[model samples]
Target: MAVLHPRVAPRRSTTRATTWWGKAWVRAVEEAAFSESDLVTARTLARGGHVGQITTRPGGFFASVEDQHGLWTVDGAIPELDETGTETVVEAVAAEAGRIAALLGGDLPHDLVEHTDEAGVELLPFGSELAATCTCEAWAEPCVHALAVLQQLAWLIEADPMVLLQLRGLAREDLLGRLHARRESPVSDDERDLDAAVEAALYAARLLDDPLS
Candidate 1:
C-alpha cells in the first residue's frame, strides 16, 4: 500500500494532467463517467482541494472528498494484473533494457505500454477496468466524490508513473527486482548451443587463416 500526501490544489491555473500517462488516466476515468457534468464537478472539486489524503492499494485508491453534498468517502478501483499479465508486462519491459532505467528516472515510456497492449495486457485502466463507489447517495457507481478521487490520482500519476504500476499490483521495487533477476538469469540451452556453434565456426576460420599465414 502507498500513501500520497495531499497536493496543493491546481486552482484552475494549470492542466490537471501534466504528463501523457496522467492524461491517459484522466481519459479512462472520464470515459467511464455517466454524465459530463459529473466530470466537470469532480474536476472542480479535485482542483479546489476537496479531495483529502489518498491511499493506494493493489487494486484501487481511497480518499475523502467534499462537495456541496458534504464530505464523503470514495474508493476507486482498477483491476490488478493477473500473474500472466504481470509476466507479460515484465517481458515487455525487459525487451528494452533501458525501460527499467527510464522508469526509475520517473519516466514511463509510451512504447512500453504499447508493447504490453500488443501482448494483450493493458497497463492503464480502460473503460470498465476503472470502477468506483462513493459513500454519497448518488445513483452513478462513480459519483462526483469518486470522480474527484480519480482526478486527484491523475495528478499523482503525473508526478510518479510508479503509482500506476502500483495500482496494477506491482510495486516499483518488485518490478526492478524482477527485471534485475531476469537480466542476471543464465542463458537457455538453445542460446548456449547457438553461441557455441558461432564460436566453433569463428575458431575454424581463424585456424584456416593461421595455416595460410
Candidate 2:
C-alpha cells in the first residue's frame, strides 16, 4: 500500500521551481525562441534573472539591471570557431553586424559599461537584456535566473562576445585603435616617392606660370 500527502506534491513542485539552476534555465529559455519545459537540455540553458526594464530607443534598445558588476567592452572581435559551436554562433552574429555597419558606412551602435571589476569581461547585451537588475545582496551576482542567463552568456562569450557587439554595430576592435594602427602603418617610402614625383610636376607648372615671365 502507498499513501501520498496532498500538500507534499505542491511543495515539491515549488521547491523545484525555486532551485537556483531550475529558475535560471527557465529564465534563459524564456529569453530565447524556445518554449518552457521541465527538462534541462542543450536548448534550455539557464538565465540569471528577469529583465528589470526595457526601452526601445531611436536606433536600438536600452536596458538596465541592478547587478553589482557592470559591462566591459573588449578591444576586438573574437576568433572563429571550429564547428557549429555556441561560440561560433555568437561570433557569426557579430561579424554580420560588422558587415552591415561596413555596408552602411556609418558608426556602429555600441555601449560599454562596467558590470564587474574584471578586466575585458562584460555583462553583454543578451545578459543585460535578459537579466534584470537587483539591489539585494544575494551574492548570486544576478538572481538565480540571472545566474542561469550568465552561464549561458559565459558559454556564448567563450565562443564570441562580438556577436553581442555586432547587435550594436560595434565590433570587438576599438575604432580609434584601428585608426591608430592604420596611421602607424602608412604607405611605405616607395609610395612617398610616387607622391614626390607628382608634386614635382605640379611645382614645374607653377614656375612656368610666373608673372615676371
lDDT of 2: 0.31
Per-residue lDDT of candidate 2, residues 23-106 (tens digit) = 443354345423233223212323223222323211132223333455321111122222233233333223332432332232
How well does each candidate superpose onto the true structure, as a TM-score? 0.82, 0.23
Candidate 1 overall lDDT versus native: 0.78
- Model 2 residue 183 CA deviation (Å) reads 4.1
CA RMSD of all predictions:
12.5, 20.6
CA lDDT, every model vs. true structure: 0.78, 0.31
- Looking at candidate 2, the ten consecutive residues that score lowest on lDDT are 1-10
lDDT of 2 at 17: 36
Taking all chains together, the TM-score of candidate 2 against the true structure is 0.23
CA lDDT of 135 in candidate 2? 41
